[model samples]
Target chain A: MNIWLLIVGVGLVSLCLRASFLVLLRGRQLPERVTSSLGLVPAAVLAALIAPELLYSSVTGTLDVLNPRLVIGLLAAAVAWRTRNVLWTLMVGLGLLLVAQGLGWR
Target chain B: MRHPEDMTEIIPHSPQFRPAFWRGMRAFTPLVPGVVPFSMVAGIAAVQAGFTPAESIAFSLIGYAGSAQLIASQMVTSHAPTVLIVLSSLIVNLRFAMYSASLLPLFVGVPLPRRWLLAYGLTDQAYAVTMGRPVTEPSPAAYYAGAAALMWLTWQSGTAVGALVGAKIPSTWPLDFAVPLSFIALLVPVLQRRPQVFAAIVSAVVAVAAHGLPFRLNLILGAVCGVAVGQLMQRWQAKSV
Candidate 1:
């Protein structure tokens, strides 16, 4: 498929998926199971994205339990959970990663 | 007579929505550190995937999503089957459907046209900033417009700039770390309940185990497994109680 065509197709699919419930289910009660599941979607999706990012080395496709990213990611998660402050999380997380790299720790 | 549109009863007047809109916009500001790099990554990745700058912009604007854009272009570059590309991108974006459902309770009073625009602009930042907000705070329509509009603008502009100069960014700079870090910051706060915590743990485990799945199907699988497991946990909790 042409790249432009592909872009459009992706656009249509994304918009349709996004607007599905918002448009279709107006004034209607959602299923009980779905309602609760939706609450978990954000956490679930983020975890799904974050786990691969923090645990796997995309370049080598190997698990890196001791990678700098894993270390700093844990630190960031702790700071985020405790402080609940984005600024601190960024300052501390990025700061630690940079510091680790500077100290010659991979 | 009460209008059906006023189900949430928050948006009784357009005048009241104006401030709410600005508040929503400002609410999304704190997320810039997270979102800007993500879009930049998407833009740069698109160009590296052998797309023309124009086409890259088209994908960014049309796709209007960071992860999906990156995933779609990467799939294209790998000559992955079109069906797989579509499935992968759809899976990546499936959370937006849940976003719509979350916005519904908050946005019950918004009109159809505005809601459509809000839906179009919904992203992780928008959803995170606006979800579960008190009904008395502001009109969801206004706040969502402010937040999602600014976020959409940042994402589109960031992609455009990233496409032009993303190739120059060194891979060693640890820019990608910002994404996981930002997500950590976002995810940590939302994990207030046991079900949420358990769901995240299950998803993390599933995601890592399924990391080798084709076309990043592991993400979709992890998400599905997380939700199912979370629901089951909730059920178990209720049963035990």
Candidate 2:
């Protein structure tokens, strides 16, 4: 398949997924249980997305317990927990990573 | 009764809309720095996957999803089967469906065309920012539009700029790690309740454990398990209290 076709196909899939509930279930109320569960979707999915990135080495594609990303990520999480500030969390996380690299820790 | 179309006209002009809209923009502004580099990584990755700048822009616009864009570009580079490419990318994006569901009630009376626009702009940032508002906030649709608009602009431009110049950036910079760090910042704020905290923990554990799943199924599995565990915890907490 052509690259454009492939891009459109993937795009359509994304659009469909995003539009599924908003368009399909318009004017209808969801059950409370489902709505409540959906409330957790943000937390659950974001965590799911973040976990593997932190634990697994991007370069090696393997689980590394001592991955610097994991360590810095945890520190970032603590900063986020404390500061509730995006810029601070990012600065601390990236700054620590740069420091670690500078020290030849990899 | 207000016609839905009338709502489209009035909503944006309503007294509540402008402030809420600007508030949404302001709320999302802090994350822009993080979003740009992450998007640049997506753009850089697309270029590395042998796409022209134009093709990369088209891919970014079409996909409009950061991680999915990364995955799709990777799959395309590997010449993976088209079906597999779409499936894997869609798997990575399945969370959007849940986001849409969560947002359904908020847009109940919104017009069809506007709903389409809202859905098109559905994203982690928009959802988190809009839903993170206090329960009694006015002009939710407007707030959503505001947040979504900023996110859309930031993402599109970031991706375009990245595709154009991201190739020059050295790989040694660890810019890719910024993606997760930004997410961690966003994720931490949303986790307020015990159930939400447990949900995040459970999902992370499951995702890491199920990391072997094909086509990024581990994410979906982790989210599902997390939601279930969260629901049970909610009931448990309620009963205990």
Q: Which candidate number has the best DockQ?
A: 2
User: In candidate 2, what are the lDDT values of residues A11-85, reduced to their tens digit?
Assistant: 999999899888876556767776687668778878988999889886688999788899999999999899876
Candidate 2 to native Cα RMSD, angstroms:
4.1
What TM value does model 1 have?
Answer: 0.78
Model 2 misplaced regions, further than 4 Å: A1-6, A57-62, A85-87, B1-34, B48-51, B70-110, B127-147
Predicted candidate 1: interface RMSD? 3.0
> Which regions of candidate 1 deviate over 4 angstroms?
A1-6, A58-60, A82-106, B1-20, B26-34, B70-80, B105-111, B131-139, B171-179
Model 2 agreement with the true structure over B1-241: per-residue lDDT tens digits: 3344545532677677798888778877876776776677678778877788898898888889887777666556657667777776676677788788878778757777778888999998888889887677767787788889999999899889989986777778876666678678768878989999999999999999999877666777998899899999988887899
- Candidate 1, residues A1-106, lDDT tens digits: the string is 4787778778887888778777766656668877778778767877887888888764566998878788788888888878877667777887998798899876
lDDT of 1 by residue, B1-241 (tens): 2347554533536577778878888888887776676677678778777788778888988888776786676567657666676776776677788777767766666667656777788887788788745567746677777888899888888889978986676767676566567567768877889999888889999989988787767777898898899999998998999
Per-prediction backbone clash count: 0, 0
Query: Candidate 1: deviation at residue B126, Å?
Result: 3.0
Local lDDT at A76 for model 1: 86
TM-score of chain A of 1: 0.75
Chain A vs native chain A, TM-score per candidate? 0.75, 0.75
Looking at model 1, the pairs that clash are: none
RMSD of each: 4.1, 4.1
User: Can you list the residue pairs that collide in candidate 2?
Assistant: none
Least accurate stretch of 10 residues (summed lDDT) in model 1 chain B? B1-10
